[model samples]
Target: MELGYSDSVRENVEILDVVSASEEVGILDDVINQGESEVVHLKVGMKFDTVDEIYELYRKYAQQKGFPIKKRSSKKDNGVLRYICFACCREGKHKTDSETPLQPEPTSKFGCKAKLSARLDLDEKWRISVLVLDHNHETSPSKSRFWRCNKKISNHVKKKLLLNDKAGIRMHKHYYTLVVEAGGYENVTFEEKDCRNLVEKERHLKLGEGDAMAIQSYFSKMQKHNTGFFFNIDLDKEGRLKNIFWADGRCREAYKEFGEVITFDTTYLTNKYDMPFAPFVGVNHHGQSTLFGC
Candidate 1:
């Protein structure tokens, strides 16, 4: 057998020495020493044909067990030897392929059959409380329908009622006031004063109908104080209003101060030609006439 620098070669050499050598006869030791030298010679004497014969024998042994050794191209360092596992047939790195079948799941040691269950509950006590409050308010005679209570007063009373009888404090006070004042009638009638005062205290203030009418009358008085003339007139050559019933009264007054009068025909042919109609008036200064038409 040819020997190379491998752990198997070393093991074989040690085994040979142990088998041949003995304490009584040194002849076996001599034989072992010669055998080691012969092993080196055997390595140098190995031919390509011998290697091929040994490989074929190894291949036959491997085939019986299903392992197949494949040889790759030789490199400067070492020849590549691909070893496939006999049972798995996976090659390289001694690992199973990623496509390998999965193992089965394990069964439970103990079996139970109770289904899970759950439910939710909501508090509905507020509905009853609201009904009780409505009934109490409707039955109470002392509750005023005309007068609205203030929030500050009601809140204070509610707290007192809660302290005295907590069950009765469930209903909130629901009424408020809206106050209206008269402009020139700040002193209300005795019968309406309490309602008006309660209204003024609780809600937005507003002007009453009487107050609005008074305001309008006051503005009218102010306008009259600044008024200079009440009517307006415009005259052309005729003694009639120029454009309409209302005209420039200032121009008429100026003409009146100069004692100037105007006259002209107040009639014209209508579209029907049978009716006498006039749509405008004119003015005459001395003997000259100027007409203003509608």
Candidate 2:
């Protein structure tokens, strides 16, 4: 047992060594070389070992051409993968709604027709079938990193971010340290926001049990008794509860009678989490202040 365990540990160390060496060598050299026409050219009938290899080559081409590519589609036959397609990140038309939202979101889609299609051959190798290099809009290599497809937080960066977070390092300082270590912002594949998001995700995952679950349970119980009770819980990107609002049937009935003048106050400091306790209040027919919602 000891011998097997030692062998496994040695194998793991060897794998780590290889990974470290690869990271030290870096992919920027290849991406930089892609600036040359001969290096970045993607011709139909190009063969690759795997789908990722096809993506890697196309991605280098996109880096040179200053466009982002996304995995658009894939096909499988009898549980065997066969065909795949990669398209410009901004290939589709943005659907507009009749009623505009209060905070309208930005969109990248513009019906750009740039794409690359590849198919699997009998030799078990993937071959490019179609290639469309024409793009409808301007492309900027300098701004390519801002695109979702181009930005990636590698495992090494994640480890560093986790370590810095555990040491109580401020986000800005840690990000700056990473930028310095990477040589410049250009060499860093991801931005500060991406690091912050990863840190938040890790922190949330570490919090095995949160107050949000208990609050949700209480809300569920309340809902069972009062079907008319309406409740809403807003969660952040990491699934952490940000805000919660609930109103019972009685509150709704009271609101119908005395909601002519409703007051919403959040001045109360009533929780250990330092979150504000907001409540909707109104005056009843008997001139008594009644609770409407919270």
Candidate 3:
């Protein structure tokens, strides 16, 4: 059978909207609404979601158990593909970097290592399977935020960064605002350089290298359909589009009548590609604003 969307899981999106070929395993007489109600198959602690969600659940469980927890280890660097396993634990003292040659001896550390591991099962919607939930230390209330996960960035801060990114805010400005919103730069898990890289990467990803065949494909479709459309494009020496003008048959006819005394406005909204957007306007016989070109 022919496949659907190329990628399996969605990015910065909901998996509920993504329907795969596997979802339509059997063709029936009547179509079923996939979003009506999902088949929630699970045991007591088992759940269906991403590994990050599982980690959050684990963290919440540890917190409810009156113990501060930290991620012991993870199987992968990114995504819940194939297989991913992570261990959450009741943390103790910080360890010294004894592997370094310049480090001193007798590392000052604590004595708590209660841990639990959650593994992703590939067969069942990447459901989290609790591998182990063991604790050797006595359970107690959290008094301080010292031995917590230092690398854990809060979801609120992440959402703020993503929202600002969508709002077209630059990185340095965003970093300043984010630091203040996060209480201080020291409170944030990642560095300023990380935010900068993320913003730069987002810029590249959002406005990727323009599709090379887009213009050609458009022109091909226009020629194939034999539409009476006029178009002009001026490119710089580097094959970059500097100026483009297009007018459909109807627009051209309107321009032919209200052609004289056309006022061109070069001032308008700004674009990232540094291309000028000028609109040609004119007043018709009825004294109403009429468009000539752009």
Candidate 4:
């Protein structure tokens, strides 16, 4: 039977020297890379909340270092990982923009050879007990923001961003504020372009295609929901809504009395769909300008 590693080989792999837990993971990663060895036994004294914390930290660290990570849980419910491993990078497209899976999910595939096992010590703290981290292939470094999935913006953040966008804050400014609120750039896994894309996506979802059919649907719903509504849609020779006059009962009654001498203005406020929103105004007996029709 082929043993995992000889005692002599184990002697050279005592490479867990770092200040913080994240840094320890980083140091172990560097040792694994430099020594071309994945069989380091780390005796860490760090305290973590849960086994998942250790796994996520290590996984994030590995991905940041341009190494593909894989993990597996012992079971569901108590479903934190029994072990985590770094997979061999397949010689294919590594671009994050490309259409492919970036991080390796939990699997029993043979491609991932580097392994790590964690257990709770007597002090009620998690420790890396067994680590077999020797990779069979060479790897390259990658920017952490490009591939990290953990640092996604939550729905709460997105809502706040949308509000800021509507309030006239610049797109780049909102992104910068979000990064600052996140504590720093390291905490934000996604890039600035991704942030801008989210805003664009929200706008697209709100406005749809902005086509003629969409406009008609909106007006149809509005007409059905109102009882005092009066609207005249004038279609051109091409069967399009060329001109529209719409008003409620109150406005139509006011127009009957004041529509004789009206001032038309189409140069004021514009709509998002590039539709002209002009209004007619007339002077009432109170010597105040009153709206006649729109």
By TM-score, the best candidate is 2
Model 4: which residue pairs collide?
38-132, 38-133, 38-134, 39-133
Model 2 misplacement above 4 A: 1-38, 99-106, 208-294
Give TM per candidate: 0.13, 0.58, 0.29, 0.38
Please list the residue runs of candidate 1 whose C-alpha ends up more than 4 Å from where it truly belongs after superposition: 1-244, 258-260, 269-294
Candidate 3 overall lDDT versus native: 0.52
The candidate 1 region of ten consecutive residues with least summed lDDT is 124-133
The digit string of per-residue lDDT tens for model 1 on 215-286 reads 446645644764522332343442322332322344345445443444435566434213333433435555
Expressed as tens digits, the lDDT of each residue in 1-294 for candidate 2 is 355558756655544443345355653442222233455778899999999988888887887689998999999999999999999988998886647687666788889999999999999999999999999988988776677877777666676567757756677766765565556887777888988878876664232356778778899998999998989988777675578899999999999988899898788864344467889999998999999999
Per residue, candidate 4 scores C-alpha lDDT tens digits across 1-294 of 976877745432321111122222232222122221243223344446687777666655555445655454342335643333333333223333444467545432345456556666556676666555555555444443455443356555566556666766666665654454456665565667776878876654133334556656766777788766667777555454467787776677788887779888777644443456788888888888888768
lDDT of each: 0.29, 0.77, 0.52, 0.55
Q: How well is each residue in 167-253 modelled by candidate 3, as lDDT tens digits?
A: 565556656544444466444446667666555544441322454347556865764575766667666565655567866666677
Residue 269, model 4: Cα distance from true site in angstroms: 32
Report the number of the highest-lDDT candidate. Answer: 2
Candidates ranked by lDDT, best first?
2, 4, 3, 1
Worst 10 residues of 4 by lDDT: 15-24
- Model 3, which residues run further than 4 Å from truth? 1-208, 219-226
RMSD per candidate (Å) reads 55.7, 12.3, 21.5, 21.3
